[model samples]
Target chain A: MTRARLGLGLLGLTAAALAAGCQDVGGTVALGVRDEAVYAREVHAVLEARCGTLDCHGDARRPLRIYAETGLRLRDELRGQPLTAEELGDNLRAIEAIDPGAAAEDHLLVRKPLAVAAGGQRHLGGELWATRTAAAPTCLVAFLGGRDDAAMADACAAARAEVSLPPP
Target chain B: MSRRTLAQVATLALAALLAAGCLGETPEEQAARALGPDTCGGGRRRGEDDDEGGPEHRCGQPCLFCHSASYNPGEKIFIMAGTVFTRPGDTVGVGGAEVALEDAAGHQVSVLTNSTGNFMLSRGSSLQQRGKGQVRVPFDLVYPVSVVVRKDGVERKMRSHIQREASCAVCHAAALSATSAGHVVLEGP
Candidate 1:
């Protein structure tokens, strides 16, 4: 074969190999489907406030590190810098990776912070949702359940409002 | 385990020395080890009410780093804390400055910086804790505090509300980065 033909043949083989490996580990995340916009608006802020501190999940040493403008950032980025789209994408992947095949109630992300009394596993971070009615937890529940754009947005607004108001 | 970074190694060494020094201490001695009264940031000891000395024991470090329940153990806990600097990238503290906080419940309270420019909002053991030129509400602070720092009539307000006030430097690092807005500064970066 000519040199150009040989190079094309090798490139085609590599592409085929990569494509073959891209199978669904979990049925939730479809191939090439990451609902970043919905997550950015509804879920990202919740994560940043709850888990994005450098002393917490935001630490670079964590396996599921959360990057945000408030605490942890991508390498070479200043703290005051904005959370870029790529960072949101990175956060989504990290969050989804915690048992992607599981349902929202069964997912590690939900089970970790959930209260022990609520049947959740032990989490050294303590119980974030003592009763599971808190805004952040419910917001995550909505998003991870199905990331329905409208439902997630409503849940997000409720969560933000709860954060704004003082305890009655 | 992987090699410890310089920061980690230095922290471990300091912790070891501190632990060794406190190994034989009594309960009362342990309680007195924390540097200040419940809320005032001016590095005063347990009985001290006046800002007579320089900055608190350690200047420029985040107040809550060692003031929380996790770190101080038997010592008092500081729910919100941080240091104010003279300028960005500068370690010189802005003494006598004011850190004003407006919580979500419309509770407006402010505190003056100690000689070392450290300010912490703590729930004192008693309601008698006080600071010069500032007033603190007796109730717990509502979250999402709006912060403004003023010195010499020149005020610099933080553009963002203090979302997570567990420690100012928790999100505000000594070095500016995408994660930290740097230390609370009176001036430039």
Candidate 2:
């Protein structure tokens, strides 16, 4: 074979590879599978801001404590690393509670405040966040759905307008 | 991606495959999902509808784990219960002490300790000041509330947020030393 023919064949292979590797705006390379890295960056902070109030998940006794230390444990888990036995159990239970395919509809998000308008009952914690899509409830919805941060921020900001922080 | 030359792209595919394998769901996560905890003290316990199981089933603290502590179905839990003593090491319960919970909405729910130094928060009694004879709009499901304990007209306020810490003994345990006996105790006159 000639040098030109070999170069032409290589170019064809590269083209096919590029087409297969095309990705969406977010960093996801494929459909399905939850992205823990995005969750750690965008959704985790939102949880800390909204859920980590005094007398709530901040306490050790609550079912889902959202203390800063817990965030560390979550970060480790997101990286696909090992968790302490205690952290593993807690995280697994939490993961089980969530529906990765339908994160917004998860009991965790739906049971929060602002869910009433979204066809969900009023949260005793008073609606931490909301969205037009019930199955895709909060700003974390966008992040969970593989949307960019800009989209998540916009969604959460809208939900925040309707949200009233419980009295101090 | 534009910065990648032909040589880089060829190598990139192989790197991506290797990285994906390393960062994918781990065996520990799978084990945790499958086997769960081996002991009662393993991890957080799921709330039980009826109080029949041992510590493993009821180990969740703050009382919400086993009881529907909230007025709203959204909270899906119940109020707190614990015995308060006159002093850290005393065996005697402090009766007639005023236990009030102030929520973020400025609503106050107060109850007196029974003879056993036990008190339970009631939805009927909450929203006393601003509820206007209606179910309080914002319920105290998992939000933060300030717990104020008063006796002899003197008040002791807990400024930290205590979401579902229904069982005070979870933090306040009996010990012989200052550091060891970390229990919530009211001062004696």
Candidate 3:
């Protein structure tokens, strides 16, 4: 019951937690869940730029449909309008519909459109990222996998930087 | 003339002017014109080669208005239709251009603009254009489509996806500022 023993025990617990929290960045899939704040900020832009083109997931008929400012909007309106909060909610619901209350990485939401070498299946969208090591899919996977905030931000930022909406 | 006669004559003249104005512009046309009134210049007059009659009619106008017009407005629900113009102020349509479209389902369809720079894809659409005349099309368009206008090896790809607005003119109206990004301009030679 000494102060030294208590301090040592706390340190040991902290170390174990940190290691457990580390994302398994290789082939191994992480246990996943959707994050609203991260999705609204970072993840949605990645999807909009890569997958949300009209000939792709931007279509409402598609199961994992996406809406973007530079891609598709849910309704007919001005072009320069930014993505609305309601539209973001609609997109989140579309992702939620894939496998309600389940991990996203285990589902097609994360698998399809991913590189074959990156453990993704060839879907209608084909391969978005050539490998899982790429920033976009990595960011998406890490966010879906419920990785730490710092990890998610880094991955997402890197992914966002590489993509931009094509000029109209 | 007496004061009463003069007043009566003035009233009749004012009434004729208002009536003529109403007869000239329909409600929808007025609404459409109001959307972007200045792009085509004030008190615009039709040019000699302006879009009129057949599929080539109504250039720089909200095309889908034909869908609900009282007369023989349109045969089918034209899902995708627009006029490609060389400049914002240019009323003449850019003909011989290729309009490429791809839907969410990975289906791609391409059509060429006739002399009037008009192209359309409708649901169960049978009417089409061959050269400067009308023909039939076997294909149908799926909604939420993306478009690209190509001419002279130049590609003007649309930056956003269309989510069920049948006419590009709905967003790109007579007034360039009022419309989405102006009327699908393909500037330069």
Candidate 4:
């Protein structure tokens, strides 16, 4: 009877180990899948909505350039630049929200604003004022008021819907 | 006598005649003879009979006059005229405020206020001889007998006093107390 009890205990341990391994595998698969189309759409929408209008982020005269043309190239520009932890966290949250499973989150929404943060009020006002444009509908004021979560989530859904990659 | 002696006698006689002519005239008579008639005229030369020129005085229309404190030369003390808002549905009519420069001896220099509630007090060209120093200027509100407003109705007679630039040290300090005050030291050193 003691030998039977030992066999049952070993089976239970093996089952628990298999369950933990399955969870790890699932997390890895979720992170590894690359949806390039979704990434591109998200990048485009963020640029259009936040950085494309004149006299705001779109104006080249501003110290920080948030125009759509340059904004799309943010990933390469911001690659090893040092950022404050608060800034890094804001960027990480934005990236994670847009690309849920992607390992490399390269987006202008995080990098451009972080770069312009040093210009203080003028740059902040310009970026906030640019949101009045119809094409780029998101305003920094709404984002500041905690209303950006739904807007960003909708943008993410729209991007995912446009993605054409087949299921693995 | 020799010919030279005879010539000297003739020169002495001429000198004596000239001396007699000079002694016969009075000082005023000589002066009258020197200066021609009509010396004082509407457009005559000096010392003439009709000479009208005396001393030049400031004659043009007076421009707006403003004055600053002597000690704190930058602070402009002016009477501010505006309707004062009283508490609880009352608007007081302030016709003008009396702004003055107070000396240590209890002397008050009164300044006039214009229609726009602006008054200027400065040393005139003749009064510039007084040394520059701070003067205390106090403002007194001139309340009208009755203040009538279309909506707010009438207000009671109210009197209030406001004091500004009372002490010399208020403006004489190294740093300026208010940004609106003009530069203490005038330009062109």
- State what share of the real interface contacts each candidate retains: 0.38, 0.15, 0.16, 0.00
Give the clashing pairs for model 3: B36-B175, B128-B135
Tens digits of lDDT, candidate 3, B54-136: 66666666656664324223444455677887766677678888888887667777788867777766544454555542334
Regions of candidate 1 where Cα sits further than 4 Å from its true position: A1-33, A117-126, A130-135, A163-168, B1-57, B63-81, B100-110, B120-124, B130-167, B187-189
Model 2 chain A: which ten-residue window has the lowest total lDDT? A74-83
- Best model per DockQ: 1
Q: Kindly report, for each predicted structure in the order presented, the TM-score of its chain A compared with the true chain A.
A: 0.73, 0.45, 0.71, 0.25
Give the alpha-carbon lDDT of every model.
Answer: 0.67, 0.47, 0.66, 0.31
Model 1 lDDT per residue over B146-183, tens place? 77889888888765455445667666657776556677
Model 1 error, position A2 (Å): 51
lDDT of 4 by residue, B54-156 (tens): 2110001011111222222123432321121212122111123333433323434543222222223343323221211212234332211111112133322
* Stretches > 4 Å off in candidate 4: A1-36, A61-123, A126-168, B1-189
Rank list by lDDT: 1, 3, 2, 4
TM-score result, candidate 3: 0.47
Can you write out model 2's per-residue Cα lDDT over A1-168, one digit (the tens) per residue? 899999999999999889888845464233235455555544444454456443345444555654333122333233213224454344334533444344544444444545566655665556644555532255655655557667677666654443323322
**Model 1 chain B weakest lDDT span, ten residues long:** B37-46
**Candidate 4 per-residue C-alpha lDDT over A105-158 given as tens digits, one digit per residue, 9 for 90 to 100:** 122343233324433223343332222222222322223223435665464444
Per-prediction interface RMSD in Å: 7.7, 12.6, 7.3, 28.9
Query: Per-prediction DockQ scores?
Result: 0.21, 0.07, 0.08, 0.01
lDDT (Cα, tens digit) per residue for candidate 2, span B62-110:
3332334322222323355545556755543566777777766676666
Q: Write candidate 3's Cα lDDT for A38-115 as tens digits.
A: 688878877776677554676667778777775456666634577788788878778777655556466566778687
How far off is residue B169 in model 4, in Å? 54
- TM-scores for all candidates: the values are 0.60, 0.37, 0.47, 0.16
